[model samples]
Target: MALASIPTKQYIEQREEGYWIKGSRVSLDSVVYSFLEGETPEVIAQNFPLLSLEQVYGAITFYLANREFVNTYLQNGEAEFGQLQKDCQQRSPQLYQLLMAGQARLSQAS
Candidate 1:
């Protein structure tokens, strides 16, 4: 018997660094985050208005199929993001302070 195959749809593409949706700048992590945040596929699509329902489902399916790998990738990506953010802060301490203050205000409002 032959192994099952995925359908030919331009939903997600895997790169050495990460997975992203095809024809859009949105990352697969963004979709997975929305799903994990208790959002349904429809809600995810709504939150990322640029994405369609089908694209969101495809990204979710890919993540579910490769949960462990995607999780590790996400963790590494977050680490890299933190490093870059730190670099940016060092480059512009005043901007970082302003951003932190704005975030604090937003948090208080919420």
Candidate 2:
């Protein structure tokens, strides 16, 4: 008898925004970050209800297998977001201050 093989599932898709779970709006970054923060696959699934346990595991496997690429992607995204934040602060100081206050309130509430 020969061992059976199955096709690998593709859990992430690259979009203009970033890598997301295929067929879902959830981002691979969300899953990877939670996993890095010591979350279990089950917990990650709970955090992103859009994803299943299998998808979470698959995403984690993909991240692990392409760690270098994913790390670079994450770093680039962080830099882009930081630049966007700076731009927003410069473009609309009042609006940025209001948003910061709201964020601070939310943090305090948490």
Candidate 3:
């Protein structure tokens, strides 16, 4: 049997910042992370609720064409998130402990 080809979608115009993800009103960096997490264009569109399917596909295409840039963005986002988590933990020990325990359980299960 022959494999089916995915349909090509039109590119969405980006905002003046040039870092806008086609599908989401959010920054390109955010969309890159979402895509890296294995989210589908449809899922991204649903999450944003403001972007069209064409925009989502366009964002994916843009990311694919600029893998290096997007990878850097993802790395920076991870670092930022880690810092935020550390700050939260420092500010709230009890909450941090609870969250840490939950994460430990989740890691063990996985």
Candidate 4:
């Protein structure tokens, strides 16, 4: 008897904004970050209800398979986010301070 072969699905795709899970709007970075932060695949799936357990496993597998490329991409994204935050703070210091204060208040309340 021959074992049946199952075709693989493309779990990740690169869009103009960034890498996202195929067929969903969730970003691969979000899943990867949560995984790196020690969240189990089961927890990650629960956190992202849009993604199935299989998809979470597949995304993690993709990250492991292309670790180098994904790491570079994530680093670049972090740099970009940092630069953007700096620009925003510089562009409107008062507004930035206000937003920061509001965030602090929310954190304290939580």
TM-score of each: 0.82, 0.92, 0.59, 0.90
Give the higher-lDDT candidate: 2 or 4: 4
Candidate 2 on 1-110: residue-level lDDT in tens? Answer: 99899887788898996899999999889999999999999988998998899999999999999999999999999999999999999999999999999999999999
RMSD to native for every prediction? 3.6, 1.3, 8.0, 1.5
> What lDDT does candidate 3 reach at residue 31?
62
Candidate 1: regions farther than 4 A off: 1-7
Candidate 2: residue pairs that collide: none
Error of 4 at 65 (Å): 0.9
Clashing pairs in 4: none
Off by over 4 Å in 4: 1-5
TM-score of model 4 vs. true structure: 0.90
CA lDDT, every model vs. true structure: 0.90, 0.94, 0.76, 0.95
Candidate 3 pairs with clashing backbones: none
The best candidate in terms of TM-score? 2
lDDT of 3 by residue, 21-102 (tens): 5445567666667888999888988987777767777778888997897678668768888999999989998999999999
Q: Please, what are the lDDT tens digits per residue for candidate 1 over residues 57-105?
A: 9899988998999899899999999998899899999999999999999
Q: Of the pair 1 and 2, which is ahead by TM-score? A: 2
User: Candidate 3 regions off by >4 Å?
Assistant: 1-19, 22-24, 27-30, 37-39, 99-110
lDDT winner between 1 and 2, please give it.
2
**Cα deviation of 63, candidate 4, in Å:** 0.7
